[model samples]
Each structure stands twice: as structure tokens, then as C-alpha cells.
Target: MSDILFTSSATAKNGRDGHVKSSDGMIDLDLVNPAENKEGKGSNPEQLFAAGYAACFDGALNLVASKKDKQIDSTTTAEVSFMKDKEDGGFKIGVTMNVEVQGVSPEDAEELVEAAHQFCPYSKATRGNIDVKLVPQAIE
Candidate 1:
């Protein structure tokens, strides 16, 4: 099945690509090289996955907090570790969420973390289908 809502252009370099669209229905894509400049500057699949995972998990955490009637005052950072699984022919993704919720007790934090894990879209998607791990910790 071909799914074409709109047409777009794409540019890729060093595994890093960019996607952009215009009002005239023109889309442009560019590939970025994360390691083009330096060792840590190169772009890789792991980095892209990490970015997606971090954003998704953080948003889920916030939603969980809101549902618990708790206000998250500080920032929530996510560290996604992508490990290679040679036998599986795919990489394993591990998530470490460092939540900065001040004034929230340990129990409350644990609750929020659990809720986040349950509610995170990424977590659900990556769970079972792919190898994923979560380490939720509060920085109060």
C-alpha cells in the first residue's frame, strides 16, 4: 500500500536527514552528519532514536504528573541507551528518566514514575516488541 498525503523532498548526509515542507505542497529533506565535525558530533540512528525516546518519555511523565494532581516544577531529562544485540539483529533500547519534581515525596515520585511508564507512548511501543529498560529516578 502506498500512503501519500503529500509529496516531499529529502536530503541525506552522514545518516542525518532533514524533512521540511512548504505551503505549496513542496517538501524538502536533508540528511545531517552528526560526526562530520567531531567524534560526538556525528549523526547516527541511536541518536535519532534517543531524541524520540527522550521527548516521548518526558511528555508521558508530565501527563502522569498532571493526572496525579501534581505540578512538575523542574525539568525532566531522559537518557536513552541503544545497545546492539547481534543475535537479535536489532538494537536494544534502554531509557533512564531523571525527573526533577521538587516537593514531591519518594512515594509520590515512585507513583509518578510508574504512571509515566504505564502511560508513555514510547514505552508501550518499545515494550515487548523491542528490548527496553527503564530507570526512573527523582531529583528533588
Candidate 2:
């Protein structure tokens, strides 16, 4: 029952070590698995997901700041780890978002980041499904 603003589709062949192409042909990247004996080099699903999530979260932070009538210069660094879920017997993702806001107090930056977590679609979708840690910092 939600209004769809936009949708993105991608096709991947050969699982983790393969090629991925988007429906819009904007993203066509070769994937390489880092778990192999050979050191293959290329992009991976986790990296892509982390990039997308970081950008989306930053956008959400900006939205919240705007609503609060505050001007913030911020940067979001997301570190995503892919690990084995011992309980689930499969792989899972863990996200740590390091957010730095310039010209803002640490308390205000923390508040903005918390509000962003509530507003970000990625955060909403991953809530309760993954472990996400938000670290807010203020830069002078």
C-alpha cells in the first residue's frame, strides 16, 4: 500500500563471481568473490549495497536537517561486513555508519543522525533484520 517512486532491477550471473547489469544499463560491473584462493579484483554485492545505503542515509540526514531548519555539512561513511550467521547457518550483513557533521554540536549531530535512521528507507527495511550501528561525530 505504499506509493512507488522508483524501482531498480539488476541481473547477476554466476552468483558471487560474475557480472551484474542493471535494467537501466547504468551499472554494469564485474563481480569478484574475495573468498577464493586466487585474489580476484572487482566489485561485490556488499560493496554496492553499502554504497547505496550510505548515500540514502546521507540524503535522509539532509532531509531531517532541512525539516529542523538547520544547515549541516555532513559526510557518511558506511562500513558493511559480510559474515556467517552462526544461528541462521548462512551469511548476513552488519552495518556501521560513521557520520560526521561539520559546524554542528555533537549532541545536535547525534540527534540528526538518529532522526535520519528513522527516515531512511534502507534503515527501515533493514531494521530488525540486520545489526546497524550509528556513530555520530561533530567536526569543527
Candidate 3:
């Protein structure tokens, strides 16, 4: 392991049908499978993953823009889908990140998004393991 920057810990009980709590007590929530969550009462793993990835990617996008001396306001939305895996007869997850960038040209926005995909930790982690689509839009 390289030099540790930080570590986050969370504990989950009863698999996908119970509860999860962070070690820092910042997160405490019920877990429900999306297929079983008819009333939308609790959070699912896919939703959590989407939130994390979106936030991370947005930060990375801002960082990349700053390095290029471009001031940009950006929002990233990560849509995560859980689907059946035909190869293994199991399940897999895919992501589509929609990024809206202001204060930049359309071409620059697209380039920044591409650079963020290469820089973001979450993107790097899921690069070869899953499918991720990046959509960049420039706003006036």
C-alpha cells in the first residue's frame, strides 16, 4: 500500500435488506434492494455509488479546469444501472456521467470532462472493470 491519505469505514448488516452505519456516525441508513424497494423508503448500494462517483468526478473536473487556468462551474450526475451479466449469469453495474460545465467553450468542456475521467479515482477504479459513458455539455 502507498502512503495512506485517509480511510473510511462502514458496516452493513443483513446484506442488502438491513442497515449500514459509518464508523464516524455520519451515515446511518437502511438498505433496500431497488427491486424490492417499492415505496422508495431506503437507499441502495447503486444509489450510494452513484452519489460518490458524481461528487468525485465533479471535483476532478474542477481541478483539471483550474490547472488549465480556466474557471469553470460544473455539475456531474452519475447514473448507475444494475443489470444482469450475460457472461457470468450474474449481475453487473454500469455508469453514465452527465457533466454540465459553465464558463468554458463546448470544446474545452468536452476536453475537461475527458481529462477528469482520466484523473478521477472512481473513474480509474472502474475503467477496465465496467462500462462508463461520459457526456459533457457546455452551458452559457
Candidate 4:
């Protein structure tokens, strides 16, 4: 696009009951449907999306805090749900990002999180396409 910073590629085969391997070979894993994965033998698309979003959001939060001259230690947990789309009779995804920030007041933590949502690339990409809820907490 506009001076690409990086690109990542992964290939998935056999749909939900298959294997996924990245171009760099760092993320080779088995794929399983969440509902059918009773034994939890493999990873699902939702799990991978959650992991990427959480890491990106947390980095965005720290960057925002640094710009405001505030130091914060934070962890972001992204809970992704796969559900039916009543509007289109298809499936959809939703995300809830629970962020805990230390070394800041609760109010400040909330503000930082809001700012991060605006800055995070993943949040921007999914802004109008999906539903995302942000919950921020301060660890005093």
C-alpha cells in the first residue's frame, strides 16, 4: 500500500480441520473448529485473531502513554466470540478487549485505552467491520 512496513503470509488447508503454516514457518499449527474442538488439539481463527489484536492494542496503549509522558504497565486480553449474524444469516465475530494498566489512575487508564483504540492498526482495520468493546481497569 503506502510504503509497506511489513507483510505476513500464512496458508491454511482443509478448512477448519486442517493445518496452517506461515510463510516464515514460525506459526505452523493445526486448525480446528471451536465447536468441534472438544479435545482442544488445535488453534482456531478466533484465537489467532485475538492474540494478534491483543498484542497490537497493548503496544498502541504503551505508545500513547509514552506520548503523554506517562509510564504504564499494561496487559490486554482479547476475548473473541464467534456468533451467528442475524442480519445476514451468516457468522460474525466480536471482540472484547480487557486492559489492565498499572501506574495510572482508573480515569487515566480509561483515557489511555480510548486513545490507543484510535491508534491501533488492528482497531482501525476492524473499526467499522466488527464490534469491539474496550474495558479498562487500573491496578493501583
Candidate 5:
């Protein structure tokens, strides 16, 4: 069982080529079908999911850093790919989270990223259900 901290709702009309709006009126945007336009004229489900995962993973990293009494001055980029499962006859997603941790040693950063992956809700949710790769990037 889980206790809810907050809840959000959004509705999409006309499928992938339509419009989506959040209940709070914060997110209102038009969606373009990726099939029609590879570089969609507007937002798409894959983009939205990538954004959410990026934010959530960042937060999870921060939380883990705080717990460990460490500070991370970095950013995470989530690259999500949506592809059709030819054999399964449906769509599936692949995710790669590139974590660039600043103010920490490369080894430490790698450790923290692994820990964050373990703690991130999105990671846990997608584990075994999807293919996710966590890549730790060194600060240049």
C-alpha cells in the first residue's frame, strides 16, 4: 500500500494527433502524430514521458544525495525512444538516463547514480517491464 502525496490528471482528445490538457490548466498543448511527422510539430506521448521521467529522476537523485549528506551539482537527461514491437504487435519504450554529476568524483557519481536508479519511482516502475539504461557521465 502507498499513501498519496499528490495527484495530477490530464485528458487527451482525438488520440495522438489531438490536444491534451491538465486538470489544473497548467499543461495545455497540441499533439502531433510521430508517424506523420518525425519531428513532431507539437508535443507527443514519448516527449511527455521523457520530460516526466527526467524530472522525477532528478528529484530522486537529489533526495538520495540529501540522505547521503552529499551535494550534486549536475543534470540528468532522459532520452526516450518509442518503437513498435514487431513481434508483439504493439509499441514499447526504451529509456536512457544520462546523469552528469558535478562536484563529485567519477566513482562516487557512478555510485550515486546507481543508488538513484534504485530509488527512483520511474525506474522501479519500469524495471523488467521496459528496457532502461542508466549512464553516468563524467564532468568535462
Candidate 6:
């Protein structure tokens, strides 16, 4: 058996399964649910995807800004969208970034979006691997 200490656990019931505590126990997450969960009781994979995409985008953009010698406010965020492709027969996940950074130009923002697409963990995970659409838009 592994020596790691268990922090939390989740069971599938009422549409959601289990919960786990992060390092800072203030925020906890349910590890399982249906593909697209109905609101209120349980959370589905869409919410998880959105959460992961948002975090990944923010982190990736931070790295991009650091590489470009630019500073970004940690408050900046990205909105992720997951929509069904009726004709294509799959799902699409679109990411739009809303950033408020000083001294950053439109071009820089564009580059940062591209860089984030390359670096964001969720972006890579969804693109090609999954039948999902990924769109990252940069906004001020």
C-alpha cells in the first residue's frame, strides 16, 4: 500500500461521486459525475472541463507573460464553453480569455493566447485527442 495520506473521498450518488480536498482545504471538488450533469445536485464533466481549462489558460498565460518579460494580473481569467456539435456528432469546448494587463498590446495578447493554447494542459488534452472544438479568444 502507498504511504500517502488520504484527504478525501467521493461516492456516486444523487448524480455526484465523492469529493477531495486540495492542499488548501477551503476548496474541495467532486471527482465524479455524469458526462453532463444536471445543475444543483451533482456536477458533470463539463464543469470539470471548464474549471481545468480556466486554470490551465491562466497558468499558461502567466508563463507566456513571464517569457515575454511582461507582467500580468493574476485576476485575469478565461471563460470556457462546451457545446454540442449536432452535425459533427461530438462536443466542442471553446475558451475565451479576458485579461486586464497593463502595458500589454493587442498583438501581445494574441501571442499569449497562442502560447497558452500550446502550453495549457487542458487545451492539449482536448485538441485532437477528444472530439471537441477549442477556441481561445483574448480580450482586454
TM-scores of all candidate predictions against the true structure: 0.63, 0.95, 0.97, 0.97, 0.93, 0.57
Tens digits of per-residue lDDT for model 1, 67-136: 7789875455666665667777875656666666565877777777778878887778777766554545
Q: lDDT (CA) for every model shown? A: 0.62, 0.93, 0.94, 0.96, 0.89, 0.60
Can you write out model 3's per-residue Cα lDDT over 1-140, one digit (the tens) per residue?
Answer: 78999999999999788898999999899988978667767888898899999999999999999999999999999999999999999999999999999999999999999999999999999999999999999999
Q: Count clashing residue pairs per candidate.
A: 20, 0, 0, 0, 0, 3
TM-score of 5: 0.93
For 46-88, candidate 4 gives per-residue lDDT tens digits of 9999999999999999999999999899999999999999999
Instruction: Pick the winner on lDDT between candidates 2 and 3.
Output: 3
Score residue 124 of candidate 4 by CA lDDT.
96
Higher-scoring candidate on TM-score, 2 or 3: 3
lDDT of 3 at 70: 98
For residue 90, what is the lDDT in candidate 4? Answer: 97
- Clashing residue pairs, candidate 4? none
Better TM-score candidate (1, 6) = 1
Model 3 spans > 4 angstroms off: none
- Backbone clash pairs for candidate 6 read 10-18, 10-19, 11-18
What TM-score does model 6 achieve against the real structure? 0.57
Residue 11 in candidate 5, Cα distance off native in Å: 0.4
C-alpha lDDT of residue 3 in model 6:
81
- How many angstroms is residue 80 displaced in model 4 relative to the true structure, after the best TM-score fit? 0.6
Q: How far is candidate 4 from the true structure (C-alpha RMSD, Å)?
A: 0.8
> Which segments of candidate 4 are over 4 A away from where they belong?
none
